[model samples]
Target: MASPLEEKTVARLVAAATAAPSMHNAQPWRFRFLTGERVVLLHADLERAMPRSDPDNRALHIGCGAALFNLRVASVHAGLAPRTRLVPEPEDPLLLAAVHLAGPAERAPDPDLARLYPAIRQRHTSRHPFADKDVPEDVRATLREAAAREGAELLFPGPWHADTVLELVRDAESRDVMDPAANEDLVRWTRLGPEADTAVDGVPEYAFGPRKRDGKAPVRDFTGRRPVADRGSTSFERTAHLALLSTPGDGPADWLRAGQALERVLLEATLADLATSLTSHALEDRDLRLLARDPGSGTGQVQMVLRLGYGPRGPATPRRPVADVLDVV
Candidate 1:
């Protein structure tokens, strides 16, 4: 067994883990550090779940998986080797993962994972527009490698396939506009006016990015027809740099792997000086999600649609205090 670690050290690791992105910035995860075993437990906070938007809890698993990945990265950065097991307890569905943090004497830290530590806090979802420029082939290859490391595939769609995916996103958006029930989750999670200034979880009005003026990027406009002060309209890139992240399976374990792959890709993109945004609006609908898959192979379930380019990086959004999410026992 590994020696016990300081609670403050564990709290810092949990803080970095919580920095991972979620469906709507919900931060739907809790961490428990078992001092005796030197293990950290990641659990899903069902209260933070979205039923209408993500009825099956696929996105929930993905978000928690991202947190798990961050915990591993933070551990490596802090001279600990993290051994992670997803869904360790078959009986408990919500017990997402268990990570044993071993000291360097037991297992050496992964240098590659440690290199990504800087990007953890640097990586933010940029809802703003990206410049019209092609991401270099080398950078794309690097991103693909990052995803593959976590047992996922990252595919950059060609022009025709990109157009098909955009159409599906628009179709999903129109459906959201028509369905009042669909907007319920949006209203509850979006912070406007004074709430944006103090809210710890959920997407703030400022992070919504500008309303799409004349671009084809599938950036979600959180405001809809509602008005916000000083929020101006801006034109986004005509052709978005879109990458589809997919896994071989469609189960809870696969969702967790996809989440890890998603964050890995995001972190690598961040280090590459690329601003990233996620478009899951289309993936929210089961049929539209199926249509968003790679047209070439017609295999692998699509988990996320990532937009990458050079533009203004988004501001850091709020996160729940580490004290609120971490418990040491």
Candidate 2:
């Protein structure tokens, strides 16, 4: 039997978990609280998997990891410390974790982390052009520390490295434009028009930033096929800030850690009044992945590339209702 306080704590954790961002806002995760054992189990909802974009379920696992991190933070706020086990069982693929709770007195909540909780709901991927002002070096270092605390590495590209990444993104954009299969996959999730039904989760029309007529650094134009009218445009910074999130091993556990780190960095940036976006274009290709990896650095593997700067707030993407995701067992 569980105490009323325990039940209340679990409910609050679930609410916070749902606040995590997901690819295309799929929210592909499910949670169950086991009262007798005082544990919360996170499971990847395979039905919600993005097969085309995430063929191997890596992105799905990443999204679940983000949710798991949120659960931990929420647990802290609710006077508990969360102990997690990633993919606790090999036989049960859907069984992602069993979180054991430690009493609040056992640990003190991190002050910086507590500050970021408010920004969790406010962080949105800003796709529009960033202001010409550069991100301070110290702030970038702080963001790196946030990711490192979550078991990942954040790589800030130098001028040459940034150019390499930009070129890779351009290559990916060109390939995606020519590949019928890739185009179809993007088309499936991209909603057209402002009045389009918001039930399905994906990149909404309004969220797609205006296309660059002069063809500068490649931005994933979600509205490539479906043209929109009167879209506003702004001048993007010439020197873009790019960071790579990497882990040691390329497995389920590593993928989860990378996801958590990714969100932590994003939330930290949000609290600092900075805008961020992620582009996995180069990471999606094997050759480009090799180029992105630094042999000297012991970082596990690059999971995602993030762009950080000061820019307009991106339009909020839609999310599935709590009732649609939560199941009381």
Which prediction has the highest lDDT against the true structure?
1
C-alpha lDDT score of every prediction, in listed order? 0.93, 0.76
Model 2 clash count equals 3
lDDT of 2 by residue, 28-74 (tens): 89888776666788999988776666777787788889888888877
In model 1, the runs with Cα more than 4 Å from the true position are: none
Candidate that would win on TM-score: 1
lDDT of 1 at 309: 98
Residue-level lDDT for 173 in candidate 1: 88
lDDT (Cα, 0-100) at 56 in candidate 1 = 94
> What are the models' TM-scores?
0.99, 0.90
Writing each residue's lDDT as its tens digit, candidate 1 over 35-122 gives 9999999999999999999999999999999999999999999899999999999899889999999999998889999999999999
